[model samples]
Target chain A: MPVNSTHYLFLSLLLFSIGIMGALMRRNAIIILMCIELMLNATNLLLVAFSKIYADADAQLFVFFIMVVAAAEVAVGLAIIVMMYRKVHSVDINILNRLKH
Target chain B: MAIYDILFWVLSAIAVGCALGVILSRNPVNSVMFLIITFFAISGHYVLMNAQFLAIVNVIVYAGAIMVLFLFVIMLMNLNADVEPQKGQLVQLAGVISGGVFFLVILAAIKSAKPELMDKTSTNIGLISDLGKVLFTKYVLPFEISSVLFLSAMIGAVVIGKKEETKPLTHNGEEE
Candidate 1:
């Protein structure tokens, strides 16, 4: 049996849900960032699958742009994380309460 | 089942399992390792979809570059399970419940929507050559704009991350 787009869609859904759970439950900022990456990857998978289903290249191009943005986002995000760590001496998100004051 | 179907099942299983591992691992380093595995598995799916260029880019950008950055930060932070305090059990339970609800709603939405399937004629759309044509001809503006975005991101990261050096002496060369 050939694989259908639904298979890929379901897989994306599962991965995305897991990423959401991790982002919500994790206290460490780094893990939360990683979870966000997971969510992005899930979207990429669904886009590529849809591109295949429709026999179109536009969605794949969109995936390419998403990857580019994700790369740039990761660079800046990790830099901010590093700076936060330097200030607080911890990677815990709960310790980020200084902004609330 | 055909080979492609088998590959899909196996790779999806690996990807989902690694995703779970990423969240559940106690050590942040372990979570990073699992995340790398998840990226590799997703790249495998890209290959099965005949997106060769994307598969290669996914491996290179995500597993190679981005994940290495994550690992370097993890090492620099020296994070462990013990150092990071856990949230309350109630909060953890609430998070899990909310995520589950979100997943169920999206799944239902996916099931309700019908996507028309096109005939498979080896479109070769996912090929690098074809993708380059469309990207350059049609999406050229966004492509160029993304480069500018990357440049700005680089400058911003450097500005934010750079350390400040304190000068001990005044301009008059006198220490207060």
Candidate 2:
């Protein structure tokens, strides 16, 4: 009995929930960012699972595009975090009250 | 159940557990580790789907490259275990309510989702040769565009990461 698409969907759901929990609960920007990545990966997994189940390459191709976007996101996001850390001396997102300006 | 079925269940459980750890862990480093485990588990899922190339790439990129960068930056920042501002009541309530709501919504959706019928001829192109052929023949344009996107991102990252010149002189410098 091979793993079915339903199993994949459940995994994606669980992963997405973790990401939501992290983004909501964590005060650290970096951990939140990691959670966001986890969420994106969950979606990608779902796409690949759907593709294979349908015998379609389009969704896998979409996953490829998603990976490219995720890579770019991390690069820019980390740079912003570094710059933010410079001014605040901390990566704790809760301390970012200066943004109220 | 067959061996693959057993492996699938075991791996799925580990993946779900690690994913939960990513959210529950207060330590950022520990969260990052949990995220790594999630990546590995997803890669295993790709393997179960017979997308061998995708599985390897998933592990190599997410678990290998991205995770290392995350760990390096976490260490470089020398972050303390100090609690952040507004860490008391409001955030906890928001976390619980939002997560619970989202989970309920998704669970409802999953319950109603129509089961997808598996392809009778899945053409298990688990081999690199077949996948390469399809990719080059049908998905050539997207592939090329993705490369260009990567190149631009590389340049963008460099520009963004460059240090700002806030001071005209350094400690040992003599400004003209």
Candidate 3:
């Protein structure tokens, strides 16, 4: 069967839902961050698909910008995670309950 | 056309399966590896969709740069399967159910969208030169701003990752 927008949509949806499940269910902060990256990619694929459907280069540029931002975000986010690890010596989110104190 | 369709199916299966592997793997390093494979599979889909620049950028930026950063951080933390935390079955099930509910809701909403069959013929929009032209023209402002953003992110990461000598953040007064 020829692939249509629906197929892309379903596949992106499934990837996104899996991302959400992984993000919510996983306690590892690093894994959670990875799931967030997965979600970002799910949307990026959909954007590329729609970009193709309309024959616009704008959506592709959006994907480009997203990569830019994601790169910066990863730099900062991983640093934060490393700092958190240095302090607590563990990457578990459960121990982050110090916010309640 | 039929070949593109077949490539799509094969790439989609690889993408989905590897994405599952990303979450299901107990080791952070393995998850990073799976995520890289998932990215490569997505890049393959980009090729099928004729998004050549994006396909290359997705691979170079994501699979190459981002995943490496992830791997570096994983290594810096020295995290292994032994350090991985397992959430309770009830919590995992609840998360899955909630996420599934979200998926079904979106699926139901989009079921009304007319599926448009895309043209897979070669296109100029995805070419490097044409994209560069547009990038340096209309989108140049955002492009410059992203550079600034990157600078700030660099500085911020250094600031945050620096050793703290002021406010203490530990238990039992130990600084190790």
| Candidate 3 C-alpha lDDT tens digits along B79-147 | 855567699999999999999999999999999999998866667887889889999999999999999
Alpha-carbon TM-score of each model against the true structure: 0.93, 0.88, 0.95
Stretches > 4 Å off in candidate 2: A1-3, B80-86, B117-122, B168-176
**Which runs in model 1 stand beyond 4 Å of their true positions?**
B80-82, B115-120, B167-176
lDDT for each candidate structure: 0.89, 0.80, 0.90
Better of 1 and 3 by lDDT: 3
Considering only chain A, what is the TM-score of each predicted structure? 0.95, 0.93, 0.97
Give lDDT tens digits, candidate 2, residues B1-176.
36767877888888889988877776678878988988898888788778888889888888998888888888778763535544667877889789778878988888767777444354666457777887898989988988888888888878877887874675689552
Q: How close is candidate 3 to the true structure, as a TM-score?
A: 0.95
TM-score, second chain, candidate 1: 0.89
**Chain B TM-score, all predictions listed:** 0.89, 0.82, 0.91
Candidate 3: segments with Cα more than 4 A from true spot:
B165-176
Between candidates 1 and 2, which one is better according to TM-score?
A: 1
Provide the clashing-pair count of each candidate structure.
Answer: 0, 0, 0
What's the CA error at residue B137 for candidate 2, in Å? 2.8
Best-to-worst order by lDDT is: 3, 1, 2
**Of 2 and 3, the candidate ranking higher by TM-score:** 3
